[model samples]
Target: MSKKQWPSWGHGEQAQQHYLVEPRALAGGGDVRHVHAFLRACGWRDKTQRGGPLALQSPDRTVRIEYQPAGMPGGWTIQGAAAPGRDAWWAHLGAQTPVEIVAGFTDALTQPRAAHAPNVWAPLREQRWRRPPETEHVTATSPDGSAWVQYRPSAGGGAMWWSGAQDRQGNGWVAQFTPSTPLHLVEAFTAALASPEPVMRPLGHVPHSARLRTTSVSVLPSQLGAWQQARITAARAATWASTAPRNARPRSTAARHHAPTGGARARH
Candidate 1:
């Protein structure tokens, strides 16, 4: 069997720059997108093609890891921010899995670069290791019974909402929002359902009415009776069908808006 060729180990140009080059092959040649997502999930921003050279920079922009892959040694250099300057910490990825590669890179960051570890890995590990959010799903209907929206808890800290209003053309919009977003925005979104004409807003960035400066309230799915649950589902379907031009009808004045169990109640 042939032995793996590793990169040379030595100190970087700067006197204070620490360097460790080890041979570590990936289990399967590393998947760049997977690595990028994992890093992004950890709070590392992709600075590729952003001035200077292409690289992934830490949130503070002090540390950088250029995406330069070398086939000879089966690894790449990891540059970290140091007090005096940046240090090059190279690894031979040919011998290690992607996980091990990141572990080693993180472990090698000590002393001058110690702060970088927590600044990067702590958030990364917290996101990757922590238990995912437990979501309680529910549906919200508009006051006129002409529009409805489904709210579901997202992986991170936010809510994903989908308009239950389908036009005669069978089109609608889906939106993901952060907790900080104003509730009025959502109300405005569902309100579009009753428009005499089809809502022309793009689904990707649905426009909302003027921003409400009030603090956004939490929306939770409440326990519901079997009868109420069935009615809610039926209403959502009915509203979707009513979007057709031929089916348009007068809005009911007795319509009541339904808020998910844990959501804030509207005050008269």
Candidate 2:
């Protein structure tokens, strides 16, 4: 590349837009927008913008990089692009690595410009590195009518889900819950009704309500009892249905005064 002396502004200068940095040298203030566009293209956010030919000053030190703005009289000389007095080459320097000459006074700063890294972020790698755990296979209906599932590869016990399915480290399961959702027909039968005879099919009515929500329900071959079937149907239907209210006429317009068509009035 070639070195640039203190030069004036050039063409293609506009406002509130992004521009690109050509591989060659920049002429003036228009290069600032181009520099921003380039950094954004490379996935760098939280950038800093500087304008005019002031000495490169970072009182806050929060600035990761610096550049000039568009449409101003003083263009730039990045790494000191087209700076007023001093040579721009001072920016192209580093302890070892070199700063890229974006424009006159313009530069794409790398490391050493930044001070240090944070502590909390030390544990996580830059990218997603490992996969999640697997699900175990110990799911069954509970005696108390609530769901009962065991997670596997666990040292006898692990985090459990209501849905009953689990693996050692993979995704989890989801179980149904209600004020009164039962796992077995026996639970519903006991809650809904009492009978002296043995239960052939699950006594469905024994449970008063299926406090839990259900999408659909059907009688199984094993659940061939009359009372159990009735309880299931009633629970499924007990949901609130949405409906719109009737449109009403305004109260002021509801009534009107009437005048007599044929008039005949006399007083005695």
Candidate 3:
């Protein structure tokens, strides 16, 4: 995708920037490496064996992330331990879920934020999702009503708190977030779902079921190469900064100038 094809941001003058009427769906299984990079940046430890699925644990052991290629239930699983006045939570991304969409959850997880309850339905609402009066559920459906998101509040005992399905024929993918999951995380996920930014996928990689909802565009191979390189560079920089010593300081110019003099001052 070219720079001009990228989505615009903000409102008014900024909104005037040319934006695609429909989002482009890119090809490829969601990249797990990006998730790993974000976790590493936030002090999470990798515990994957040579041939095992990817696994990571938080510095405090309060959160866990795992990615299974087989994806019997879900390919990506993230869990948080119970905290003060808050219950334990789990989120799952199906194997077919897009990396850009999955990144929304991980990105929000790594960000620093004040403690407050976020309105999980706000993003969906802004996108014209319907909430029946006095009901606990909010729903958003695709134009053809094939794909939809159903959000149920205060669900209990193995009930799905958030459920998303991509096709009516049961051939597409599904994702779920369990009860007590962080609202902000769900908000981020919904925001990403409602975002106008196109997801770049190769023509061959785009799913047959989702083609109707996506716009076909000629994305250069170099664009994917550059995108991957930029992500690698950012992840490396973040890792370096995170691991740097807090107490370390650079030598002053005076110290550099006096290095050859040892403890004695040179006579002028």
* Tens-place lDDT digits, model 2, residues 98-161: 0112211122131122233322111111212121234354333323222232223345434322
Q: Per-residue lDDT tens digits of candidate 3, residues 77-182? A: 8899999988999998777666666777876776655487787667766767555455456666644444456765553566565545454334455678876787
lDDT of each: 0.33, 0.24, 0.59
Between 1 and 3, whose lDDT is larger?
A: 3
Q: Candidate 2 at 259: error in angstroms? A: 85
Model 3 misses residue 230 by how many Å?
2.8
RMSD of each: 29.0, 35.8, 13.3
> TM-score for every candidate vs. truth?
0.25, 0.16, 0.68
Of the candidates shown, which would achieve the greatest lDDT relative to the real structure?
Answer: 3
For model 2, where is the 10-residue window of minimal lDDT?
259-268
* Least well predicted 10-residue stretch by lDDT in candidate 1: 17-26
